[model samples]
Target: MKVTVFYSSDATKSAAFDVQPSDTVKSVKQKVIALHSPPDWANTALLAEKDSTEYFDNRKRLAQCGVVDGAVLKFTYARNLTLMEKVELNVQGTDTGNFQLPPMSISTLPPKVAAY
Candidate 1:
């Protein structure tokens, strides 16, 4: 079974590996974790999908999600940021001063409430 591990960070990359047909997603994740050591900020979290449909990580029914050849396993790094903090980020265009942004959603939380 050929599985692909996608690591999301400052950039994205795909890593392909061969495993047994009986291999589980959890096993595959362990292999990926060993291959690409993630930083402390990124605790190994996976979003296993095939053809745009996400596979549920029900540990009980591992075999339900068929593991065939050429199945794409995408590994993603979740951004640990508050909703308000995400909105404050500035986006810049290729050319110097071209900046575009969507309307910000004001937070009801008080300013004294610390944002990570």
Candidate 2:
């Protein structure tokens, strides 16, 4: 069985892995971490689908989590700060601040605005 994993930070980046129903989520997460090399503070979670918010438990097998062959799982991370966010903070010339901005999707921003 093959499973497609999509990175939450960058949907354009995805990887397909050959897996078995018996494979545990933790094992899959290890594979993904090896391939993507996410930040040290980042923790990976597997979402069953693109629109699904529910995540699978690391202790559960793929079969037990309702994952089937050819399923598309979204690989997401919980971290301190993303690279982009860090850059933005640095550009502001401050290590600590009380500014809060709404999350912006690259697709929604104008090409020129999104370019930076």
Candidate 3:
């Protein structure tokens, strides 16, 4: 079974992996981390269905979690800031006790405009 995984911090960033029904959520997360190579600070990754409140347990198998082939799973990295967020923080000099901005969705972006 093949599943598409998207990073919650950046929906535009996603990866596809060929997984087995018997594969555990932890195994799937390993594959995604290997492929995407997200920041080292990323401690935990949670796999959830898009627009769904339920999340798969790392100890449970894909089949047990009701995951099927061609399913879209959103990967959320909890307890750490994303690479882009880190860069922004550095640029803003947050370490210097300067202004701090609230955490927001990195996936949201303004619509593109075409140039003549």
Candidate 4:
């Protein structure tokens, strides 16, 4: 089956790949980086447009994540900056940091956090 990964920022830019349903999301991302890496490719992630319910674990299979053949996955990266990041960028002579947070949403506390 063939899958195309498109840049979340620009749909016009995308890359297609021939992969099996069992292929891991990590492999797809690696393929993009290896064959046609987008800008700032390091530490990038592949997000499923159809299912953004939970975090896409690196080991998760494309089929498990609802990424079927012909499905277009969003090639996304962290966009917003944290408070410290904003400050660092504004402060003169400060070197830019390379840290990038993953996309997240407010949800019920985890078992550990809820217990606490």
Candidate 5:
């Protein structure tokens, strides 16, 4: 069975994966971490999907969620801020109350820093 994994930093960021049925979310995450090898300070959020809906970590098991063959899985890390974005957000005079950031460009590329 093939499962997909998707993850992002801002809730909107996402990626797809094709993996084995036997792989747990944790296991797949380990593989993804190995494959991506992100930096220590990055924030990564993991998510699983079945059909169109997303999975919550509290109730489901990666394997028992019927992540059968050819399933598309998604994981995301929303809080992983780039240096520029981080600086912008942290500015002392920044109008954080009304601040709105532009939409992030979601990509298939793996994260450079691992946001745990």
Candidate 6:
């Protein structure tokens, strides 16, 4: 049986797999990461075609999960946090609304400690 996996947010980020009825969801995720996914495959979730809210168990077999050939499995993974993103998360929330900030790139100019 053939199953297609794609990112829930972006359909363009997807991969197709030819799997057996006995294949586990965990194995499918392995291939998905190997092909062209973020390194965080363990966090990737497999959503069934019928219900977007429900997730397929990794230990369950394709046949047992009601997955069929041509079934579209939407997957979503957590993104890695950058230094600034991590810093923002550590910031405490107050009654004045959340202190939110966008990630940034920094550059500096050379210092003139002893200019004549």
In the range 7-83, model 5's lDDT, one tens digit per residue, is 43445543455665455666666666654555566576555663454554534455676666666666544455565
Give the Cα lDDT of each candidate: 0.60, 0.78, 0.80, 0.69, 0.57, 0.69
Total backbone collisions, model 1: 0
TM-scores, all candidates, are 0.52, 0.62, 0.61, 0.56, 0.43, 0.57
Candidate 4: stretches off by over 4 Å: 36-42, 50-55, 79-116
lDDT per residue for candidate 6 within 57-76, as digits (tens), equals 88988898888889888776
Which portions of model 1 miss their true places by more than 4 Å? 9-12, 50-55, 58-63, 79-116
Each candidate structure's count of clashing pairs: 0, 0, 0, 0, 19, 0
Q: What residue pairs clash in candidate 4, if any at all?
A: none
Q: Candidate 4, residues 2-114: lDDT per residue as tens digits?
A: 98777546558888899998999888778776755456634455466633535477898988887777987766665455656655675666656655544546557764545
- Which tens-of-lDDT digit does each residue in 1-116 have in candidate 3? 89999864766888888999999999998887777666667677788887776888899999999899999998876655655666677889765333446566664778678998
lDDT of 1 at 20: 72
Best by lDDT: 3
- Stretch of 10 with least lDDT, candidate 2: 96-105
| Distance from true location, Cα of 28 in model 4, Å | 0.5
lDDT of 1 by residue, 27-109 (tens): 77777778777777864456576344474472623346766677676766445544444445432222332344445567677
RMSD in Å for candidate 5, one decimal?
15.9
Candidate 5 ranges beyond 4 A from true positions? 6-22, 39-41, 50-53, 56-60, 80-116
Q: Which 10 successive residues of model 4 have the least lDDT summed?
A: 46-55
